[model samples]
Target: MDLNQMLSEIEGGNDEEIERLLQRYNSENNRTFTFDQKEESLRIKLCQSTLAVLRREVPFSCQRTCLETLRIMSRDKCVLSPVATREGILTLSLSQNGLQEDNLSEEEERVVVEALKCLCNVMFNSPTAQQICVDVQLAPVLCGKLHSADTWHHEVGLFTLRLLFLLSALRPDLRMCLRKDCQAVTLLTKMLEHTLDINWWLTFTAENNERVMEALKALFNLTLNEPEGEEDVRQCRVIVSLLRHVLMLKTETVEKTEELHSHAVNLLNNLPVSCLDGAGRPACASASENLKVKPEIGNTMRNKLVRLMTHVDWGFDIMSGCEEEPRPNPSEDMTEEQKEYEAEKLFKIITELTRHDMIRPMVVRPDGQLGSLEDKLREIANDDDEANNSDSD
Candidate 1:
């Protein structure tokens, strides 16, 4: 009936406690109560509530039943409440600490799997849940859980799968580590293919076709561009599918074009030279030199970003002022070597404009572990030793 009652029951394992609290919280009499009390009481309910008791109370003491219940909720709730949800997931994570063989009890494992299923949906669907993943040691601990079978960690796998697939592009920090793990790409590739399955489609009952497409887009970004692996060429072909879909949308107007463009840039900014075939070569002409630029990744990512930002135009300027008198055309007088040097410089300008902020959300700054983009550009310059050596013995 009150906050104290809700906490006591939830802690004592009264399965019906959360719903009763929610029902009471939503009732006419409850409207007069202070928001704080209602919010406070809800947190306690969520903290104590397990997945097994979503809309029902405990029917048995068996752990398997409890685990199964959690899974049911995972398939049910798209938006989990903030109060209990965070604690619910952490508590579920902690439960694995009790495993005898360093793996969860089958039922306990199910609790985590379903709980994460619910958590991932909220993490992506609710802004608050997204914050909680970062705020409460969720991501790093998740990384640790993914470290081994001792983690016998299953749910976190699903969570990481969603996080890596959806959040990797927006956050560069995550991108670097995702590249560290070999399984990151393999798991994502497998999941992306699963999207075609009817079983996978049915799992997204609460998610509409648009959200599904966005998920597909995010998944492509993770696989196609963020990480370069043996499968990159194949993945690129699959990723190209998105370009056609977005272009075909006659109903998609300019309202979200800016946001979409930013996403597009994020996708393209990471495109390596390897993605380019004969046709894509011009689009990826700078990539051969990029490998020379990136020495070590972490130490240089931000620096690479800087160099990219400096070289690429943000498309903010339209007018160029000329103060010098026009010079005579010098093609006749210039040496072949000199002419080649100027032509190389022109290509760098084209490369920068093609990948600039106006076209993509690439923010480049200079300095750090990786060599600057300018340095890479210089290496790719026609005057670089590689170019000169290829011309002779």
Candidate 2:
């Protein structure tokens, strides 16, 4: 029950006991327990001790509980820096000491997953931890997980990426490393393109949605302001693949469709404005003869985006008559503020896409179904000018 007694048991106890002790402090029902400052300090000490054991070769069960305890401890910002430094974040990052996918037991795999999650939790808001992540070259280790054929690995990779995105935003140097040194954009593209099967839509889970959303969001952060970063993504022909994926979402049942849509569209907004050829000239949208996106594919990409922009129910119709209760619209669950922000992101994407000479006319031409976005803009400008003129009088 006391801190020293708890540590003794954890250092010498069996897995069940260890897990029970950890859960006792971490249980959601024990909300009042979190307010005890002394107990919180004890929790940090326990986390440090657990991580110390985690660094060595231990029973797989013990390793898991260690990770689980750390995962819970990491939720407290007060403990994060100490855990990051004392627990050896950098050491755990090395491939030799870290978790791997090859020849893993199911239990071992779960342990690896928990370890990754624990790291994510510690690094979530701690600048020191985030710096250590970059200094230790953690991105490559996480990238390896992204390339694994196992879905669990993919899930872990994305979970880690979400943390890295936050770190990179606060540290430009880390962002550069992730983009240029770690090649995050390229690795994320591969993960995003990992298709399950022809019947993949049916098998998709919340895990899949989270993975793809994080991947897109990470790429968006990496490429947001760096021209070279954006160029690297453009060279990967991200627009073509991203557009196709968005189109496929119509038939899919994802838990966070709005997040996926928002991220995908934001990434599209981040892509290089002009996809050019090697000759230093504007590449024809219809010709993929020399570019990463093929000619025919380009048109299909545009059409798909247009369809999404125009029709909200294009893909949901097929799910209308299902035997089970209809899946709730994720949009309805969103806060009013969040919904407004998401709508702004969509509007920005539509605005940016129409800037291309090829797309502008089609999207805003008179007689279009959505009416002219250009006309709307001009009308707003006129209203503003008239207001200014009247104010002068």
Candidate 3:
């Protein structure tokens, strides 16, 4: 079977022809696969038509085959090449059409979303596909579609985000590709905003929520190391709102899901001072007391989020003190403004590191941040003493 011909059929949603081609290709490729389950599994990926075919077959009884086919495709690099990308683009285009066909049930829609997710593994993570994303103008198109109220379009939109999520986990450097697009930040933050619609994309139970989480994670990784500017303030606001939304969830399982909590911490880690109110409201407000993040609470957030990471992955631990410390003013330590300032600074650093690179500080040997931070603290501690002496004078 010809590869281009198979791709055309996939574009048209013809599954049988693609399957026939797959079985024949597998027969030829089968001999090459060694029987150890892991290696044997890699053999299943040998056929070029496998991912495209399984994506179409997702609704059929053989769903497991497609799932495994995609899983295998993700593990290897060859599946991400140009030819595979054409197949993925065609797959998503086909997914767009399927959304309009009312004859399909929600179950089948889910199958397609899952299939699109498979296609995204290549689009977001595959280095080969990076050029394709720019050539095809994929990021903005997908972000726009994500906002569609139509269910089918919405699902396809979410499917697009799933690709972004994989890109972050599998290829940390590709995040710059997204930042180049002027709309990328707003596109990502919109998904994070607290929605009046419980069924909206970010809500945990919503069908599209997984895609939202994927984008959130990817955006978190993308901005982790990025420097602060005017927009960093808004980014922090968007994150705090997301945290409030997650904490508001009534379900113990969902709220406490190790995943969601980690997300909360990730946002907190990158919280910037510009975005934080001295008082710690969603935005700075004159009405409230300052937001205080106790040192222990910060430590707890780090511990809970680390479960998602591996031992080799670095920079999870964060300890901070006020900058320009050792102040002569006793009033500084107890104020709400001071407390919120410290929390914002700590979160911002974590956020920067999380967004830019997976590597965190090893910290076995000090970066020597502690001693400098301690002296600053000592100066701040003298604020009251200095003030009393001045008053006496």
The numbered model that scores best in TM-score is 2
Give per-residue CA lDDT, model 1, range 1-393, as digits (tens).
465665566566444554454444335332342234335445434434544353243332333344433433332233246323566555444543334324555555554554455555445555565665555655455444434422334343444445545555444455445545534433433343443232332322222223334444454455543445556556555544443233223223443433343343455445554554442323333554543333223433334333223232433221221123457997879999999999999888877876773433232445333445565666568567877798897
| Backbone clash numbers for all candidates listed | 12, 1, 26
Better of 2 and 3 by lDDT: 2
Model 2 spans > 4 angstroms off: 1-4, 11-20, 23-34, 91-97, 149-154, 196-204, 229-236, 251-255, 276-393
Looking at model 1, residue 224 earns an lDDT score of 49
CA lDDT scores, all candidates in order: 0.45, 0.62, 0.52
Measured on C-alpha atoms, candidate 1 has an lDDT of: 0.45
Please write out the lDDT profile of model 2 over residues 1-393, one tens digit for every residue.
467888888789866787677666556523441545667677677767776666666677766666766676677777765567734685345312355565667677667677767777767758788777777767676666555634555545555667666666666666677767676777777666674232355644666777667777777777776366446746446644554455457324533655566567767666664642231234454553333222223335444344334323433233221123457888978999999999999988877887665466424545435655677888889999999999999
- The root-mean-square deviation over C-alpha atoms between each candidate and the true structure, in angstroms, is 18.7, 16.0, 17.7
TM-score of each: 0.38, 0.61, 0.50
Model 2 alpha-carbon miss at residue 376, Å: 42
lDDT of 3: 0.52
Worst 10 residues of 1 by lDDT: 314-323
Off by over 4 Å in 1: 8-18, 26-46, 49-230, 249-265, 273-393
Q: Best to worst by TM-score, what's the order?
A: 2, 3, 1
